[model samples]
Target: MATAPPPKSQHVGAAVAEKATSHVAQYSPDEKWAERSRKAMQDAITNPPADAYAGRSVKNTGNLAIAFRSLNEILVRNKVRQTVRMTERHEKKGTKRRRLQSERWRKQFSNEVRKKVQLVIKIRNRGA
Candidate 1:
């Protein structure tokens, strides 16, 4: 007697379809929320605060440093050692002013402001 082929063994495609349908049941809203929260936290950590550049003088202090550097380059090109001494004197004056400011005063001044103040001193001295 020939046995009937085991009810044709449900199609392989049907087995895959059943698995896909059951997968929807396995989803947890809590897991999705946790994933989203983690992503948001990471994004926040990577981004700078909104006021990041508000106090930074991209023009003034930055330009002054560049000017000083270029001035040194010009002096080197001219083979003048005297301007280097002058640059050192200006830097020393700026450093002295910075050192003279009490810690309490420095705490009141932002870094950019402090840098601009020093830059001003360097400029006036350089001109003199």
Candidate 2:
């Protein structure tokens, strides 16, 4: 006698599991950093402070240094605060060093944010 085919539910479940496994396998450290950097750049551009580049001519003085500093400070503070909140939510899970390291990473990430803002300023000035 011929054997019957597997159930439809089994096929669907296998396909779903394979898809989920493939997604997880496709993840890489580089992709993660790229996504994070893209997000930081977008955030920096979208929520620029009201006083960004204030009291200085972009063409002449090009107060990019001051603007970068201000933007970096804001970004770093926000990132650190977010990290702290997340750690608090997951309290008793991570070590103190892990928390400190996360804060340090957030601070370093702010430098990238500053660089992004500077690049935008340069492009805008060039276009003007």
Candidate 3:
């Protein structure tokens, strides 16, 4: 006797999985970045700084800069080399020209941020 075909539910489930995987594969670089940013924001909001810094709450304020600063401070206290990158812009006093001076502003990141990013990836991969 011939075996019976798979149930309709199995086919539907396979199709849903294919669609979901295809959607993920089609995410653009910007979309991926936005997704990561959102996750980081959520993590920051969930885990607030322990000490009160100038009575400012990184979570409540919804400021990524402040959250980064807090994370950097924690890394510093723990003697971690990974730090957040920061950049500043300044206008020179002269003719009708504006130029950024290297000495005036710099973009820098420590090894701690990398570690943190890796941790985030691990957490995401584990479906947590």
Candidate 4:
């Protein structure tokens, strides 16, 4: 009698395993960075900046809008970064750090009409 062939699911599982292994080999360095980036991004998104950046907190929604607004801002920023990277010359590491630091400092609410609107809105309404 002839030997039986493996089941269909086993063949599919093996193919997935092989593909995952190949991707790992392709970018070994990205593995460690991926975890760190995920945690950092999660924290940053969870705790957003205050609404004082609007220059004045004339209308207070308790910062509930930051979580909503930041998502689109991040996407537009990503597109801007992609476009700038394609057009401009490569910038120095220090330049990138300085730019981010300046942004952080500028974003800090000044004494004038400073108010916070904490927005704790990330994945909402999980399955019942």
TM-score of 2: 0.27
Candidate 1 versus truth, CA RMSD in Å, comes to: 21.1
Structural similarity to truth (TM-score) of each candidate: 0.24, 0.27, 0.23, 0.23
lDDT of each: 0.69, 0.75, 0.66, 0.64
Task: Looking at model 3, report the run of 10 residues with the lowest lDDT sum.
Answer: 82-91
Residue-level lDDT tens digits of model 1 in 37-91: 9999999898756783333323445678886776666656665686456567555
Residue pairs that clash (backbone atoms under 3 angstroms), model 3: 82-110, 82-111, 82-112, 83-110
- Each candidate: RMSD: 21.1, 22.2, 19.0, 20.7
- Regions of model 1 farther than 4 Å from truth: 1-26, 52-128
Candidate 2 deviant stretches above 4 angstroms? 1-94
Clashes, model 4: 2
By lDDT, the best candidate is 2
The TM-score-based order of candidates, best leading, equals 2, 1, 4, 3
lDDT (tens digit, per residue) of candidate 2 on 1-128: 99898886778888898778885756598999999999999998987766734433233257878776766676575575576676675555467678789979998999999999999999999996
Task: For model 1, state the Cα shift of residue 45 in Å.
Answer: 0.3
- Of 1 and 3, the candidate ahead on lDDT is 1
- Count of clashing pairs, candidate 1: 0
TM-score of 3: 0.23
